[model samples]
Every structure is written in structure tokens, then in C-alpha cells.
Target: AKVYYHDFVVQATKVKRLCTTHNTITVNGQFPGPTLEVNDGDTLVVNVVNKARYNVTIHWHGVRQVRSGWADGPEFVTQCPIRPGGSYTYRFTIQGQVGTLWWHAHSSWLRATVYGALVIRPKEGTSYPFPKPKRETPILLGEWWDANPIDVVREATRTGGAPNVSDAYTINGQPGDLYNCSSKDTVIVPIDSGETHLLRVINAALNQELFFTVANHRFTVVGADASYLKPFTTSVIMLGPGQTTDVLISGDQPPARYYMAAEPYQSAQGAPFDNTTTTAILEYKSAPCPAKGISSKPVMPTLPAFNDTATVTAFIQSFRSPNKVDVPTDIDENLFITVGLGLFNCPKNFGSSRCQGPNGTRFTASMNNVSFVLPSNVSILQAYKQGVPGVFTTDFPANPPVQFDYTGNVSRSLWQPVPGTKVYKLKYGSRVQIVLQGTNIQTAENHPIHIHGYDFYILATGFGNFNPQKDTAKFNLVDPPMRNTVGVSVNGWAVIRFVADNPGAWLMHCHLDVHITWGLAVVFLVENGVGELQSLQPPPADLPPC
Candidate 1:
């Protein structure tokens, strides 16, 4: 009901972490950028000015753009990036979504530092479906590199190898007391006894899933991806990049400082990750201060091991809608897409330096054996709207080109994926179901697949390849969780359904930056509907040029 205007200036700033200083790109000079708070149904007009050296685009993650597809920024997906010294205005309204969502830079590697929370409360004069909390806080879990993150990704891109892992994990931009020279600046959340607080936890890490827990406290999860869920209590929560969880915590423990920490939930076997823990303190207002020249450490929580898949599975399975949802039963499009990593045999023309992956190969990923390639001359949306040709093809496969044991030992011959800018076409208002099957070509890892401009219901998920006959019966048509992002389990599959009512070029990809760089992505082009109301709005005048 209200319009909010903001100016986001992306610039370079000197930030020190892990006892080292690095020049970091940031928005408004904040490492975790800026938190945008609005009520449901409010309109946001963000003028993003690219003062940094890199081209950039800001995405309002989990905010269904509806008719405003041009503002759903994903670099070359919806619109071109705003070049350095250039500016672009993104205008879109948040519709019926209310809970925890976030905003981040959609361009290459800039989101490592240019990201923040987008908290949506109930509309004005309206209240939450559940009881009110005493206060609210945004816990942004992020990754930090001692070296420049852009440089890190750039080197990986040049070598065609996996990027270097982050030096440390972060909580609100600090590495916390666990690391050197961080105790003084560890983020502290103050609370009063017997008061309940809402914690909007967002995992903005570039390429890692995280497990979060507060010492001596259990969380009652109330919402995720800006949608309310049936409240469930859990000791820990796992979030893939671009995912969010809203949980309520009560200050019922004895008056003391308790550590709230986040660490990597590394699922890929033999893959390296930052094993460090980042922490914040939940301090009671009545707690006594430390004596002179003496410091007291907060009570640390026992976290799950990095490879704890059982806990992750249990936590994921617990999510359900607060009530029955209108899950589409009659599917107009049913896609069984295989998602996994591959190894491209090193090309002799490129030389050894360029092919630094396993056994001198290049790492790649695909959906249905086609690696996604972004167009350089024009964005997908622009090409589609302006009738531009040769930008992309509408021949993305509905299923794998060659079928085999998806979760079994795959042949080395199938490890290479062909690269193309392909998109799947969908009619307006068509009901769709997609079986995201994880394969074991190179190795299996959890993929946080995210879609722009739409939120879908997660009907069911299970380990191993998804079978229509056996797994279709496992679908939960009623009370299934609705989300904009779903973490396809390692060597597993997840079935999701949604109505293709939003007309636009929407990018669906793995949220892990490295995996997306390896081309685990696709686009869905939803055709315009009957009238103006159901069609995509016109592109803004200041839309960035390619």
C-alpha cells in the first residue's frame, strides 16, 4: 500500500577480516549491504548506482516480481547489468508474500559482499498469523575471503577449475570470537528474560550450505522464503544459499550470554570448504558484565558435523504449509530434469593451465546434458520482448537426452555437457511439475535450486532418482511447503509444482555460485496471457544497455 524509495550506491571499501585487509565491493559501504524493511503489498523503487569497477545488478530474491519482470534482476536473464558509472532503477511491488526474503547482487561474485536482508512484515493494520514477538533481528550468514572474492572467481573461471573456498564464514560481517581479533566486534543480540524474539536467518554464502543453532535454545520455525509455515520446533536449521528461515526464540534460559553460531553443512564428499564457525551472542539484559581485565566467553553450542545429511534430511522434511495449499494436480508440463556435475575432458588447444579440474579436466554442470550459457549481446527478456533472434533457443529438453542410472555410477562419456543458451517455453497459467533429479556423474552434492518471479510448492523429496510411479504417491498435495528455493538433496530428487502465471524470462539455477558458474541452470519463458493484467509490464526507460 506504500511506496518506498532507496538509493543503493555500490562502491569499494577497505574491510579487514581474518586479521587481513581486503578491498571489498559493497552497497552503501555496508558489508552485508542494507536491510530493506517493508510491509506486505508495498512497492519498492531501488535506484542502484554502480560506482564500483564491476558491472552489477541487484536481485530481490524470493520477491515474486509478478508483472514486473524487468525488475527481477539476474544479470543477463531479465536485464543487463548496470555498468560502472551507470545507474538503473528497479521498481516492483511485493505482493502477498510476508516473511523473510533477501536482496543480493546478481552479477558475478559481487554478492559475496553486496547482499542484505529484505524483511516483509504483514500489511499495515494487519498482524502476523501467530503471536507477536518482543523484537525482530536479521541474522545474515555470509562467507568472507581474505583475498578479493571477484579475483577468486575470476581465477577459477580462467583455469576452468573449482574456485578457492572462503577463508572464513561470517555472521553479520564478523568472523566472531572464534577467530582472531574478532571478539571485540562479535554481534550481540540483547534480550530480556521471558521475551520472544523473531530471528530472520538468511544464508547469503556464495557456495555453501550452513547449519545454524543457538546454544541452549530451540527454535520454533514459523516461516521460510517469505511464506508462513506450520510452526515446528528444531534444535538446528540448515539453509542453502538464497534460502531463508524465520524462527522464534524465547529468552527462557538463565540470564547469561549464549552463542548463536553457523557453520558449513558440507555435503560433497572430498570437496573442501571453510570449516570455521562464525558466531553471535544472545545476551540477556540482566546478565552481569565481565570484571576488569577479564573476559567471559559465551556458551558455545554443539553443532552437527559438516556431513550430517540425516539431520539435514529430517529438518527439511519437517516443513509444511500452515494449511492445505492449492497444489496443481493436473500438470500441463511435467519435466524430469537431471541436475549434477560433470567433467569436461581437457581440450589440447586450451593447454594445461586452462584445464585444472579433476584429471586435467574442466568442471561443468547441466540440466538434461545441456550446460546453460548466458547471452552476451542481449538479455533473455529483452531478446524475447523485442523479437531479437539468435539470443537463445526454446528447445531445452523436457528430460535427459540419454537415460541411465541417475544416482549410480555414471559413464565417463556422459560427463561432458554441451553448452547452449536454451530456454523452455511455457504457456501462461499452465500448471507445471518438475522432478529435479540429482545425478552422480562426477560427484553428488546438495543443490539449492532457485527460480525467479515465482514461488512453487515442494510436493515431495527423497534420496535416489525420482520415480513417477513410486514417488508420485509420496507427493503431498495438501499442506506442502511453498518456497522460492528448494535444496535438492545429495544423490536425491525433489518434486515441485507451480502454475506458470507470471509471464517473463525467469532463470532457474543452482544457488551455489560455483555450480551456477559451471552451468547448472535453465530459463523458462512464460508467454503473455490474454490481457495486460497478466502480461509483463514494459521495461523501464533506464533499463541498462548490454
Candidate 2:
């Protein structure tokens, strides 16, 4: 295995988009930052220098990190944020993972512009499970706000309401020709006749799910979240934030330019979202060029509607492992966690501006009724390792404190969630299954739940409340698809199982940044097992202090 070293300078750079220039926080002054390519079993040592004003930490999303919990960089979960003018090194190995993964800032709202693709090819002397594509491209779908993202979130935090929706959806940091003043900067993807290409599609958007399509080409999905899947062809695909989909596209259409487009998939009934489309041109090498003075437009694909839940459901249900897999049948720790939004009554001392949510209430979210709050004094991992007190409590509930009809009209009393820095303790080698139930507390919507440090098999998913008596029989234990993230369907539930083999303080939360900001998260503190190999590594000397 090879060890790769890199320097990431997180600096503020002035960038123009949507006819306005703003100081955006970026890595190495690159908008989408840098793409790091490595093979499976390779080690990465990234030194992140926080030159920007905001505290920052980079998370290697979907990279298992193995025994390197100290490098799993979720602020206040695994490690403290690298403060301004501070530097921290993340050194970890990519163990047994291949295909598309990503890296992004794990701090407050910084990931809006601070993110990148982490591509893992097969290990040296090994070949891909499928035929090699003639070319590979990373399509990063993101969001852009006219105002400063940090300021936007700060205002939301102050007002105790939902933040302003983004101004535009982006494709590789460009709003594309569909928006004003973007035609000249629209990304163009090149292709040759009859050749196959790999598209590593990543959804790095902060608060939106996206539907992606090509004008005249079909995609054979081969992998997701760095794990191989049974190849299936589709005309459209949906990706929630922090999810990656690997699809192979063949240049079988007429020699012309077609638009590769993405639009929002807003499942929340009345929630406002960026209903704009961002596009890139897929041009064939043999296509004719337009006259110098003439303007030609590429053919655009018909994307799904913003509220197309049926399409999203179908796309997610199609994923399967290519081979019969090992899904744990005997679960040791079974947990039923409710994930959804809630409303907190405005305090009497607070003014109207601070209670701007529906009916003068503040928006909140939770898992099993506990709204996760991060400790400011120290990180959870550091507190646990050093025997520090008052950082967090290991009392996260395994189920909702009070059981009600999850998808039904919830009682007003249950709308308020308690806030705390709580974690669930687990043995290092226990087999676990979690039934992530989506509730209709405020409004039902798909929550892309992501777990750090391990990939779990998505056993099954269905709408309405989860009944283990009936749903357990529907589990696809033989060939369940493995992923680091799964989208809990709107007003529904999903069952995922995995072995708790890696020792770490792993944060599991909604991929939507806004949801996490409102406290839709939990931490799993897996105790170290016997011996050094099964235990977490010691913290680095340069680890950032709170």
C-alpha cells in the first residue's frame, strides 16, 4: 500500500456566480476543491491548514477510517475543529473500499463551498469488477447561496427558524446556462463515439436532494458509496446529500451535444427549495461546431418533478448487491430510532424575531426524542479517552421514549424534543440493526441518514410505520446492498444491519445540513476491543484543541 500526503489550505477566495461576487471559503482557492484519487488499501495523510476565518475540519466521507478514529473529523464528535490559523493532520487508510466516496468540511456551514471528491480505484495488481470505462468524471452536485453561507446559518440559528433556501443548484460549482450569467462558465463534458464513460456522481448539496439525468443517454448504475452493486440501467437517478452513485454511460446517441442536468427533489410537502436546474453539456467529439457568431443550445433532459417521491422510491429500491452477501441474521443490539422534525415552543423572554417558525415556534429535530447538542469544552472522543467529565452522556435511547403512530398526526406534546450531548454505547464487535423510522411530527420527508466509519447493509425499506412482525419477513438478507448512507423514505422506515467492528465515536445523522443543524443526529461510541488491531489509534500530537 502507498501513503499519500497532501496540504489543504482553507482560505477565503473571492468568487463570482449568479452575477455577484462573494468571499467564499475554499480549499486551495478551488471552488469544488481538489479531487484526491487513491487505490484501495492506500493511506492518506492530509494536513489541513485553516487559513479561513471559520473553524474547520475535513471529513473523509465514506472512508471507513478503520482503527483511526482520531482522524474521523466531525467537529466535537471525533475531534475539535481546526481553529483559524491552526493546522491539523488527518491520516487514515482506505480499507476494503473502492469506487466513489467524498471529503467535505464537517464544521458549521463551511461545506457549502469546501468539499471534494475522493475516488478509490481498485488496489494495485487488481482490476475492477466490471469492464473499465474509457473515461471517468466526477460530477459534484452542490448548492449556492447569494449571501454568505455562514451568515445564513447564523441568522437561522439566531431566529430559531429554517434558513433561507439556496439561490441556485450547482453542477461542479457552476449554476449553468439555465440561470443568469452562467452560459459562459457552464461545464462541458467531452465524449467520443461508442465509448463508455464512468460518472462518479456525488450529492454534496447542503439541504437538497437532486434528480440527475442525461438528455439521450441511459445510466447503468454499478456502485454507490464506494461499494459495488448489481448493475442496473435507468434513465434517472436521485441522490441525497452525502451520497455517491457510480453509473456507466455509453456514447450511443447521435453525434451531438446533450445536456446533463440536475434539479431538486423536494419531498417535503410545503417546504421551499431551489426549484432551478443546473446543467453541463455532454458533447461528442464528432459533433459539428456552431458558427462563430451563432449560438447553439444542447438538448435538455426531462428531469423528474421536484416532488417526485415515486421516482425516488423506485430508484432506491433497485439497488442490490451483485453477489449473495453476509447480512447479520442474529442482531445483538436492535434499536428503533425515530428521525424527524419537531417544534419547540417559543420562550416567554424571546421576542418574535427569535421565534419565527410556524405558529411562533422554533424548528427542531431529533433521533429517539433526544436533540443532539455538541459540547464546546471538548470533543466527545477526547473527553472519553482522557476521562474528562461533563462533555457528553452515554444515555441515548434505543427507542422513542413514548411510542405513537410515527407517520400519523403526532400529539402536540411530543413535538418538543429534549436537547443534550448524548451518545449510545456499543460493544466493539456486536452485530447491530437499526430501524430508522421517519416521523410526521412537523412534516414527513426523506432523511438521508449517514453513519461514519462503517458501511451497513440496507435490508429493506417501506412506507408508513415499521412493524417488525411484518417487515422482518420482507428483509433481503441474502443480497442486501451495502452503503454508508441510506435515505429514510418520507413517512416511512428503513432497516439497516452491520457489525460494530470498528472502535470509534461515529456520528450518525441526517445528511441534510439543515436537519443536522436542528439536531437530527446521534453518536455511537463503540468501546475498544481486545488488542491493538481492534482498538482505536492514539490521537496525533497536532490534534486541534478546543
Candidate 3:
């Protein structure tokens, strides 16, 4: 494979669309950023130059950093931000991964404007489990905030409450029809009567899990998070924040314009804050007898409700064995943890003393009571360079003291942080299992927990609390969806197992951009094997200095 080296300038550009205009930041001047096509095993050197006003860093989401943690970009977590006018080159090789992944800005709120799809095809002789499509199109779903994203966050931090909702949800950088008044509005897709199209859908929304569907077409979900799944067909699909689903649509139907729509899936507690759904028009080509006007009565297929707990549970179960691809079962290490929201006394400057949260108390989520705070002096990469053994605690609780109570009054609960949480220690090549329990406090928000490096098997998940006896009996030891991230359902807990074969400092944290910014993160250190990973060669001279 050829070595891929590229330079990108992250700058703000004024783009005019749908008769309105706004200044948005882009990489190399492209609104949707740039497409990076590479093959398995190929090395990539991406020099990112920050010309925009905000500090930034680009993270290769879902890629196992494996001794290259410096390139794992999560501001403060992995490395310091590349200051404005500064530059940083991310150097790493694609190893054992051949599918769709993505890259995005990892600094505060910058990712809202900066992101692109990273496509990795298999090496020369490798074949896909399903037949390859004639053409592939990336369909990225994002949230559009009319106000400056930085300002939105700043106001939220100052108000001590939920920030204002976004103006519209976007598809490939365009807000389809919903925000006609907004400058970033996009024209919807026009489909031919009998066309089959591949839609590589990515949910980059900061906090919501979306249910996606076209008016009448059936979608076959084939791949997710850079890995192909055992193909499955569904009318409507649910995608959590930070998750990706590749679907195939067969437009074999009457020619008529229909709306492609996405809405928040119901949470365990109740409907989303805003019940309005985002809509995109899908125009099917005219037939021999052209209709006079667009059909507003196109069939709206039955989709799961935003808070259909049963369906969500079943869908999650179906992703486990033997209905899915086989996963290696022998675990090398087992780590258990409890995740919950706790209250902290906000200093006088931030807000009022009495804040509303779970149980009426001000709340913040944590991994086993200890919210992992990013030290101002340490970068996630610098910590790895200094070694991971001492940077994180290894004593996280094996089991939680209290499971969530969906119907209980969380607002009145008194909460405190868990001290001395344990971190996991593993040798390279050790198989591992991690159980995460959720404590119900305030609201039951979905936690899309993402891990760097290796994909793991989701063993099981349950509500109320985890019953060790019953849950263990139902564990799927065979086929499971090999994913780098899994959603910890509201008021529920999940168990995941994987192999610690990749060496480096990896981060495991909530995919919710807001939660991660507030510090729901941890590091996984995989010790090096004899010698080093073959891909760990020195970077070339003249690399961009960021």
C-alpha cells in the first residue's frame, strides 16, 4: 500500500446556501471537510493546521491508537489543542481495520463544524462479507446551532441548566427543509423511481439517539463504526450519538416525492425535550404519467417511538450471538464499574448554590463516583508518554452500591463522589470484560460509551439493576456485534468484553460531546509487547509543527 500524506488548513469560510449565508469553519475550505481513502495497513500522516480562531485537535474516531496515543485526539484527554495558527501532524497506520471510520475536531464545540468520513477499503485480496455497492455516498447527520457553538456552551455553563436546543438537524452539512429560515438549509435528495443507493449514515449529534427512515423504502443495515455487520433489513433504524450505520435503499416503487426523516428515539424516562422531528425531502423521479404536484401523502412507515423501551432492548439483544458474527470469548481480564450522576457544590462564580439535578440535587455523571477530571497541566498524550501506570486510578468499584430507580424521585437524592476508583491493568493480548452499571439520578440520559483501539463484544444489558445470577446465565459467549462503542441505556447497565491486544493509552468515555467536555473519561493502558509495534517508526522530517 502507498503511504498517504496530506496537509489540511482548518479555517473559517463564508458559505452561501439557499439564499442565506454564514461563516462556518472547514478543513481545506470544504464544508463537509475532505474524504480520506486509504487501504488496510497503509500509513497516514495528516498535518492539521489550525487557522481558525478556536484551538483544535483532530481525532481518528474508532481507530485503535496502539502505542500511538499521541495521535488519539481528544483535547486535554489525549493531547493539548493545536492553538490557532499552530499545526500538528497525526501519524499512524491502519491496522486490522477495513471499513468506514471518521475524523473530527476534538476541541470544545469545534466538532460541530469540522468533520469528514474516513474510508478504509480492504487490502488487495480481501473481500467484503456482502457484495460491494456500485457507488458509496457518505450521509453524515449532524446538529446545526444558529448561534456560535462556543457561545452556546459558554451560556450553558453560566446558566446552570440545559442549553438552548439546536436550530435543526443536518444531513451532510445541510439542514433539510426544517430550517428554511436558517442560512445552512440544504436541498433534499431527489431519487429516481428504481434506483438503489448506498447511504453511509453517521450520527454525529452531540446528545440524542436518532431514528432514521425514508417515507417508503426499506433499508438494509450492513456496516457500523468501521466494521461490517451481518446484514439485516429494517424499515427504521436507531442510531445513538457517535454511532454510524451504513444502509442500502432500493427505490423500487412508484415515483413520488417523499420526506426522509429522523427523530429522537424515546428515552427510557420519556420523550425528548423537543418532540418535533427533522425532515428531509426525497423526490422520486417522475413516472410515464407525471404527477401535477409533489405528493404530501407519501407513506410514513412505522418507526419505533423515542422511548420504546421494549423495542430498544430487543434490538440490542439481536446484536448479540448467535444472530451476529462470532467473537472470541476467552477473556484475559475482567473489570467491573459503576456509572452514576453525582452532585458537586459549584463555586460562587459559575451559578447559584441550589441547582436542580437528579433527585433535585445538582448532578454530574461519573465512572464509579469519581468523575475523571482532565488536569490542566496534563495532555492525554503527555500522560501516555510519562507512562499510564500512575496517571489513572486502578481501583474502580467491582459493583455499584445502588442501581437506578426509573420511577424514583432522583431530584431529592444526596450524592457524593466515589473515592479511589480503580483503573484496569492489562498485558498486551489479554482478553478483557467490563461491566458498567448506571445509577438513576436526575434524568435517564443515554450514555454512548466509546473506547479507543479495539472493538469489544457487548455481552448483556438490563434495567433496574444487574442481577448477577440471571444476567450471567444469559450472557452470549459467541457471535456479537464487534463495536468500538455501545450505548449504556437510561437507568440501565451493560456488560462488554474485548481483547487487550492493542498497546497504547486508550480513552473510554461518553460519546455525548457535552458530557465528555465536562470530564466523563478514563484511560486504558496496554503495555508494550517484546520490542514495539512494527508501525511505530519515527515521523518524517518536515512534518508540520502544530
TM-score for each predicted model, relative to the true structure:
0.98, 0.98, 0.87
Error of 2 at 162 (Å): 1.0
Instruction: After superposing candidate 1 on the true structure, give the runs of residues whose Cα lies further than 4 Å from its correct spot.
Output: 267-275, 290-294
lDDT (CA) per prediction: 0.90, 0.91, 0.69
Report per-prediction Cα RMSD to one decimal.
1.8, 1.8, 3.9
Worst-scoring 10-residue span by lDDT in model 3: 534-543
lDDT of 3 at 158: 51
TM-score for predicted model 2 compared with the true structure:
0.98
lDDT of 2 by residue, 1-546 (tens): 999999999999999999999999999999999999999999999999999989999999999989999999999999989999999989999999999999999999999999999999999999988889999999999999999999999999988888998988899999988789888888988889999999999999999888899998999999999999999999999998999999999999988888898887765422222337888888888888731211566886887777778888889989999999989889899999999999888879989989998899889999998999988868999999999988888899998999999888888887689999999999989999999999987664589999999999999999999998999999998999999999997689999999999998999999999999999999999999999999999999999978
TM-score for predicted model 1 compared with the true structure: 0.98
Candidate 2, which segments miss by more than 4 Å at Cα? 267-275, 290-294
Tens-digit lDDT track of model 3 for 394-475: 5545444444443245543434654332345567777778877666754457788989777887777777666677788777
> Per-residue lDDT of 60-162 in model 1, one digit per residue for the tens?
9999999999999999999989999999999999999999999999988889999999999999999998889999999999989888888999999889888
Q: Which ten residues in a row have the lowest lDDT in candidate 1?
A: 266-275
